[model samples]
Target chain A: MALKGNLSDFSIIQLLNLITLAKKTGALYIESSSKSARLIFREGKLVYATAGMDAMPLIKIMARSKLIPSSMAASLSERYRSLNDMELGITLINSGYLTQDQIFTGITDFFKDIIRGLFTLTDGLFHFEAEEPPPLTSIPLRMTLEDIIIEGSRQAHEHEDLKSEIPSLDVALKFAERPGVNIRDINLNAEEWRVISYVSPKNSIKQIAVVAKLNDFQIRRVVYNLLQAGLVELIRLNNPAAPAPPRMIPARNPVEQRNLVNRVIDRIKTI
Target chain B: MQTQTVKIVVTGPFNAGKTELIRSVSEIEVVNTEKKVTSESEKVKNSTTVAMDFGRITVDNDLVLFLFGTPGQKRFDFMWEILSEGMLGFIVLVDSTRPETFREARGILETFRAYAPTPYIVVANKQDLTDAWSLEDIRVALRLDSAIKLLPCTAKKKSSVKTVLLELLYAILEELDSAKS
Candidate 1:
């Protein structure tokens, strides 16, 4: 069965832990407003990873790392255009252009980079398709996710802290009333200034993220700092459709409610 | 003599075994409106409740308890508000073996809280499974308040179901007692 959830509810650390503990073979697809990533696993170990619509080809990665001459890389790319990444890597190793260790190292580093970038995303949707095969065009590796999970745990904790402070991205921000500190006296960074420019009760933190070209974690961090400094305050937009607090009991009188509950308890005890 | 009825809601994420929980304890046949699951993502279960599951127990000749299980999908969230009206208490069930649904369970709990300030308990179902998360881990993952009761349960067992109901009833009784004095 497929497993899916929002990142806000399950952090990447938890997801990796589950994958490792369960020894699951699957492709975990993660997507946010700005980017999407796919990490394929075999028997709970990461095998391959690709981010965005256009991932850099293996040959480019190899040549960029100076393991192979750029001229040879261009020639190989044209000659092996029809071959998938795995096939091309094999051909390169067989042709003595690059060592097996060199190819594996280059792909492993690429996978790490993609996964590390994913750690910074605090909000997104993730779906795990069990037993799904890796892409034919991608070069697969067999690296344990333990190291990556250990590294990402700290970021996950920071994300959790930020999330607790500002629970919802739907919440808008506005300048605090009666600021304890002068706005002019406080120093704000470029990103913070950009976020401040979009501060309005009409614009949600999510909208600000898009306009300011900041990711979920980045935007939340800046807004959190602004809040801590008393430069801004959260504005919960009026949701007229939100459910009203329910009456304590269908019965109107507190005495009646108490008696009713006592009777139910008595009945339940008999069951 | 007129019969007095009280409503109690059983809610959680999709496939947390709401139907089985009610079936284990409901004296009357549960009136369920379930449909074959058409969504690819939810095909883990062959069918899902589209509307609601209604069960009843006769406390006595004069008192009856109505158990309403809300549908588990996001599309049916509106029904949660409708079914939660005037509920004396609630039970939030989580499939302990599947951590993926914990977030959805938290969302359901938050929605119910917004609708009412009633007493509720979170049940970690499927505890019989070897892979089921410990109650402590589930509680921390869901970020439940320390005071909130986190009970282990296997929904198919009548005794297990009874324990959950009794705990909820006790919580309700305690809430009422607090209100009185």
Candidate 2:
């Protein structure tokens, strides 16, 4: 039950429960472009966690060894404001509140769990890039680079199909060279975006045909547009039956439902 | 590039427990001005940030987060454009206690579909109330998208709160995966 993947795939909370379900114990290292967090679990329970920024003290210690304005860190510490834990450490270092070493001290002091890998599960690093307004840093953590690769690979794979399906889509994607495609100007509408988002190699034309509410020819046209944009990778599905799960859900009676609402309202009024 | 910061707005139409959910799991005290929210101000409150609450939680100290709760009223819908854009994802709260909340719930649901369709989770809050509504019932009432995972929740409980947040993060990441593929 304790599965592993990028932070882009699972949230820490759900991952914990999955681990809790399996009663697993291991170290999970989750990374994105800027930083990494490691969670250590012992028999399904969390013990400690830390991130690459935990190495900041090592950075500050190095920066001080290099004399990169020790006061620069102290001055910026006061102006930093954010709700993210990992960002605080970065903000400190970038804002000049603490030298890379000072913030690293703060990170290790608080993020010791991340550095120690106390969790009993091992999850891969996510490689997500954060776009924000902030100052720059001199020395980056070693783990951050690995994440960037994973995320980049992830992006490249998603849009491969539409690129191949529609030659036009291929051109736009190559020309644009960005994650999102602008079918808005191309008369493709939002429904097209829905279909475009699902053009993975795992899904075939038929599977998409069922969900898209669009015909195969229409889908191909949309896929063609996507192909020109390099937004998807159209492929054939080997397991057509693997698509939709059965609807074990029961149908409801309209009168029973409205009656229930009325009774709940009456009860509330009485209250 | 560096680690990305996810600025998430957890909102729904009125009476959806947006504040309660925040209160349950927030490591820091969540600022709540609950009195500012009610049936009367539903028309013109156009986003007072009633509980424009703030909190922090460290996860292995790698993920930095900013949690925002917006009032769930049609009037406040305007602020959604500002809050939804640039957000990592969203967790939409659904009120299980009152069925009438569906109209507003549907409005926000459509907003998410039309605007912030990336990765989002739906929470069926107030599982503790007497005559508790079933999960299936809430889903049907809300007519939620099949892909959206709606977890039964009593935002006051730590376990419930934690699971909801986890599912929410999962949804966002999954959306990223879909986009990547």
Interface RMSD of each: 5.7, 21.6
Error in Å for residue B174 of model 2: 2.4
Per-residue alpha-carbon lDDT of candidate 2 for residues B1-181, written as tens digits (9 for 90 to 100): 3543446678886767777677776677987555543455454343335436565554323344567787666765566666666565678887676545654676787776566555677887887776455665456545565676988888778778777766666565555456556
Give all candidates' CA lDDT scores. Answer: 0.86, 0.53
Per-residue alpha-carbon lDDT of model 2 for A135-244, expressed as tens digits? 23322221222232244334334434544444232121222345365645455578677776666555665566568766444565666666566555444323224322
Off by over 4 Å in 2: A1-271, B1-4, B32-51, B60-62
The DockQ-derived docking category for candidate 2 is incorrect
TM score of chain A per candidate: 0.64, 0.24
Give me the candidate number with maximum DockQ.
1
> Model 1, A1-271: lDDT tens per residue?
3366678668877777777766778888899876789888999899978797466888988887788799988998999999878888889999888889999988887788888888777679888887988876677679898888888987867877998888789989999998778878999999999999999999999999999998777888999999889999998876447555554444468788878877877787777
TM-score of each: 0.55, 0.37
DockQ of candidate 2 relative to the true structure: 0.02
* DockQ of prediction 1: 0.27
Docking class of 1: acceptable
True contacts kept of each: 0.47, 0.00
Which pairs, if any, clash in model 1? none
